[model samples]
Target chain A: AQSVTQPDIHITVSEGASLELRCNYSYGATPYLFWYVQSPGQGLQLLLKYFSGDTLVQGIKGFEAEFKRSQSTFNLRKPSVHWSDAAEYFCAVGRGSNYKLTFGKGTLLTVNP
Target chain B: DVKVTQSSRYLVKRTGEKVFLECVQDMDHENMFWYRQDPGLGLRLIYFSYDVKMKEKGDIPEGYSVSREKKERFSLILESASTNQTSMYLCASSSHDRLIPYEQYFGPGTRLTVT
Candidate 1:
């Protein structure tokens, strides 16, 4: 079975500060990782995904993540944060041909002015 | 762009009542999924269909059943709604193309409440 763990349950950052959300996964084989964001009362939107080839993946709204094989981590990062970026973020790992994803508990991001 | 739409945005049902949640995708995706979201837990897959008439149980499919009569639509059913089933239901679809297989596009979601 595959699983994802997001160490931070909630994160608070200033509007202009840089941010990083940690994610770790337990998978037997090469993992397909993804980051998704959900705003209050809205469905989730894909921030980015890492399938293969690249260790550093770029996503929408000026976000990026680095996949580290040794550490089993795919952490999302942004140089500057905005108030609108406050939302609940999830990390997921996909395995097998069925395309089933195992998601983390989620990290709630709070942007302080 | 892919568009996934659910039948309702909010629903209130009584305990033991039958509930149906419909999902339709416009992009001709080969796969459709039903998931439930809670406060602390992320999305948990209830059921998924790879092709018409083919359904698979996900991690938490005990109290849920699904129907996929058409390629573009997938429906999730709760035989008897319970208070524990009150949560946000999300519908998503993804292409099965080998090149890009797992990026799922989601609908706005239906918030279901059972009392």
Candidate 2:
């Protein structure tokens, strides 16, 4: 079985500060990882994805993630965050056999001034 | 850009009522998925179809059914709407594999309330 775990339930960051949301997964084969962001009352938008090759991938809105195979982790990071960046972040691991995905519980990001 | 549309932004239904939430994708992607989002639970897949008229159970499939009669449309059904089933329902579609740009495209979502 495949599963995703996000250690943090909630995180608070000051505006213009760097942010990192941790994510780990348990899967058998090579993993397909993705990060999604959701605002209140809005659907999820893809922030980034890592399929193969590069361990690090860049995404929209100044987000990036690194896929560490040995650690079974794919953590999302941002050099600097804006108030608009305050939203829920989700990390998911795609099921190798069925192409389905398993998502973490999500990390709620609160940006402060 | 690929587009995915859900039929309703909000719905209110009584218990035991039959409810249908519709979703449509314009990209003719080979795979479509239905998911329910709850606070602190992230998103739980209800069901998905790889092709028209074909469906597969997801992580949480009980009390739910789905229809995909056309390539572009997928409908999720709740035979007996219950209060516990109330949540924000999301629909998404993607290409079959990475070769075809398989990132899932999501709809704005239907917030269903069963009372």
Structural similarity to truth (TM-score) of each candidate: 0.98, 0.97
Highest lDDT scorer: 1
User: Candidate 1 residues B1-113, lDDT tens each?
Assistant: 66899999999999999999999999999899999999888889999899999998988999899999999999999999999999999999988888776888899999999
- The 10 consecutive residues of candidate 2 chain B with the worst lDDT sum are B96-105
Report the C-alpha lDDT of model 2 over B90-109, residue by residue, as the tens digit: 99998876663447889999
For model 2, the stretches where C-alpha displacement exceeds 4 angstroms are B100-102
Error of 1 at A113 (Å): 0.9
lDDT of 2 at B89: 99
Docking class of 1: medium
lDDT (C-alpha) at residue B113 in model 2 = 93
Candidate 1 lDDT, A23-100, residue by residue in tens: 999998888899999999999899999989889999999999999999999999999999999999999998677877
Superposed by TM-score, candidate 1 places the C-alpha of residue B34 at a distance from the truth, in angstroms, of 0.6
